[model samples]
Target: MLSAIREIGRLVVEQVINPAQSSGGKIITIVLDEANAALQEVGIEDFDPEKANRYLHTDRGSKGNAPAPFAPLTEAKKTLNKIRTWLSGCEKVIPKTAADCDLVNTINRALGLDDPILKAVDAAAGLLQKKDRKFLTVKLEGGKTFLGDYEVFRKAVAYFADRKAEKSCSTGCACSICGKIQEKVSARTLVYGFDTDDKPGFIAGGFDKTQNWRNIPVCSECRTFLTQGRKFIDSRLNFKFYGLNHCLIPQLLVGNADVLEDIINILSDSHKSVSLRHRIKRRLTDDENEILEFLSGSKDNMTLNFLFLQKSKSAERITLLIEDVFPSRIRAIFEARDHVDSVFSETYNFGKIRTFFSKSDPEKRSNDLNKYFLEIVDAVFRGKWIDFSFLTRFHMDVIRRGLVKDEYFAFRVGSVNLTV
Candidate 1:
């Protein structure tokens, strides 16, 4: 499992970062001019500016209008301190441009002041509140804001990874995932969001002493890989279905990155086009077909996996379902769907299919529907007959209770005809 997570991370990094580097662009650079301009706009004076790397970090408002500081202020300070440390350590590589010097001076000045950092934090917070902005990200050189760019953040993480590797291991034991004997296994935390209440769930180990990180014994390298991989997945491969809080993460092996991206794009676009009527549309659009065909054509040795996750009551993310299927299986599933569509295309115009799969409240219906839906898709892909008993019973109950009005009744009737 640790190997799989690490492999996923590697794939993500390759797909995301390699192309940027190949294009002759630096992964991240200090935008001295922009940072100086922003600081000047905020009315700071006479401080020699420091060149700072453009990186993503979060800041939030102080609590109410009270004079006392809040958690967001503390978080902002920590983030600034981290950036300052990183910058100070990399003085050799930092450009000696005028803007860079000014940025460094400004940072030093701010740090020296007892209340300037607080003032800046409050000013940014005020902008967020007055402008109704979602983020309080700092502006940097080149008019670009630090919007939490993963590539930039990865460098910081790499620095920490080196430090972590240097730590002495408490117990030298064989890693559970890699089978290598190593000292000092660490827990891997997968962070999905920024809320303080959002629990950082462990991928390899948990809070329980019996199931501690040491017990799982993942080496620091693997642990770092897992962290980076989760960050990439959360940023790029994750999508929400409708308004539900659940996320669908697609993992692909043996397929083109462009094709996988297209598939995810279709899913995201379809999600945005969902009707206001709360009806779930299962049919693929014309645009979706082109990409699917491209995906299907490259299925010689391709494998695809999906994870359906939702937040638990404790605000921790948990996988609700998982599906691992080959490209051939996906093609088979598409064929089966077409067959079903043909059977009902004339009488009900395939309306019954939607009715059979309708999910009004995703939170309540997702697990059962996702499980059974995948089961049916698998059965069809495997060239086996699908069981319609569950659908039949559900239709009968809806009719018996007259739970659906005329339009829905028509759909139920049309769906029943397809079952026969």
Candidate 2:
């Protein structure tokens, strides 16, 4: 059946799809040839970036297994070939007739805004285009939480935030193009529930950089502090707020919008501007439609998606179930590990914690009436704990019977670990 589907797909591509001229193969070939030809085009002995890193007449240290110098000529030829091939193909696909001008202008005309305002708009747009970039981590913000895209962030704030005459530029992620040369850091930032907390404590951990800090981790106190504002900015410009999945927001530091706008306006002269209507629309609401439209226009520089999962609650239930039996016998023990760690920590700091067994009275006192049921209760709980295997099986049995009453309700436990 899979073979039949592939056969049909191939047939459609071969028949219905006209094979337009493509220099894809040539592009790959040129890329492959770039290393050999670099010297002729670039005027360097080789593209040894390390050697290039040195200033004029600077001393350099020699490392073992020095790589061969790169030839820059190959790279230049490769770029020229790529552009030529691309433009050739583009001309075929794009209409050359003046008859198409009105159709193009229809998209160009933003009802009331003039070319000057449009240029400013275009400049603002250019700021979001992330350039010379690697990884970026943005803390989740309430205003931008719904945005879920860096591309949108670049465009929305890159241009003038205030149209009122006295309004000024803010952060500087700008354009070199004069057309809006928008750029945004493409790195994903998140408030992970506890992606990696090196220190194990009451709540979860701080963001795990290795894991890209993706979830919301909150303590009991921090969770309670969320009611004060929709979004709050601290002196550090770090935004803290609630995000999706009822999680606390991560802190994202923004770039300089003022410089970013200046550069974008300069670099983005050739590019068209996003409309004032669009700008006003973006600034006015936090609705999904407007947010999506803003992101949709961004040229795929950054994309973000949020997934919802009930991790803490799930982990809690799993932990409780595993701790049901005394010293738990889940075979794949986890909470037992945490329990062992806890006990070790307690014993290690024994000198620091001598309170549990330290009652004010030198000798302990118990009522004679309590002595009767105490032993019986101990016996009942102890009978299940005498053997690990028997205890595990017994724990599972009691849980099954108790769960029949209600999924979350558990009646008995040898270790008194029952939630209900």
Candidate 3:
């Protein structure tokens, strides 16, 4: 798993650093929606100098409620202090371009401000009575202003990235994935599919004083690569099937862009064509064949993996249902689905089969629905026959639901007759 993640990270960095791509660093900044609202309250069409300065510098109290004059000022001071640290450190790492110089000057200017920016921050803190403090974002206008525009911010982020990569890892153990002896296997470098949650401990290991990132046994370079790869997959190669199942197709390519495009098209077609709304079920089999043909073109050389994830109720972590399935195996699994569809099609339409198997009632659906799907998927991939009892149960459910229409009922009866 560590190796796979590292490979993905390498791919991401390759794509990102590609001269054609426009990928860059990201920074967090506060959005002052309440301050804007406060300005608009006084029929100020355009922000006055004092209001604009205040809006740019400070945020509403952390809770969004109007607090004492010092509350927002304190927050503003914290943000400025962090920016100052970044500015000071960034000078050593980043080349001093004109924009970089301007950004540095802006930060220095804000730091030195006593009356307008700072004083307005205090006044804005006192005036804001609403509890609608906006989120910290890189997407807002004022935030962009604080960062001296997106291009400069991107440079700054790139500088930070370089600095982070150059830092030494603390752990000297050989990387489990690369088998390289190196220092600096920090957990801060590694990226997980989901955010680390300490409450239920979804991150899989303790991040305490005694046991740190050393437990993972991944080096800093590998960790950075994997993190980038995860981000790229999350942004680009991820998709949904049945709107309920989240799937990620991470491809290991040897510069075969055509094959990659074909795989993406195949997956997209499968997603669109196999839905319950689609009546011509046989088309799905054809689509599966198209995918199979694409996979076979590689002759088992290309590696394609799938990850199916489910979000936890608290939305803190994703529970993986299926991880790292090969494209060839996925093709076989779909072939099994095609076979199952054929068997049911003789009696009922494909839609009915889907309806029967798929969880329709969110309230009453078994928690084991994903487990059942995983079982079927595994069975299909392995070319093992689905248990006869499973079909028997489906037949029983159909009878109990009074869904046994004429031809369908006859087919069910014939199936039972053959089994008996």
Cα-based TM-score, every candidate: 0.55, 0.14, 0.53
Candidate 2 segments whose C-alpha is farther than 4 A from its true place:
1-74, 98-337, 344-420
Q: List, residue by residue over 1-420, the lDDT tens digit for candidate 1.
A: 335446556554455332111111111112324433324332211111111122322111122221111112234455455445544543433456665455555644544442555465555555443323222223344434442332423343444444433332345777666678886554323223222211335322354433445534567666655655555445444544322223234455655666555544444343432431133333332121123333444454445444445555435443443445566765665676668668667432223443454453434645344444445434544556766686676567656545544434665566677654
TM-score of model 3 vs. true structure? 0.53
Best by TM-score: 1
What shift in Å separates residue 42 of candidate 1 from its native position after superposition?
4.0
The TM-score of predicted model 1 comes to 0.55
Backbone clash total, candidate 3: 4
Query: lDDT score of model 2?
Result: 0.24
Model 3 Cα lDDT, one tens digit per residue, 154-225 = 555544543432333355667666888876454434355343334335333353423334445556567657
Segments in model 3 whose C-alpha atoms lie over 4 Å from true places: 16-169, 188-190, 193-209, 251-297, 312-327, 330-354, 360-368, 402-420
Better candidate number, 1 or 2, judged by TM-score: 1
Of 1 and 3, the candidate ahead on lDDT is 3
The TM-score of candidate 2 is: 0.14
Ranked by lDDT, the better of candidates 2 and 3 is 3
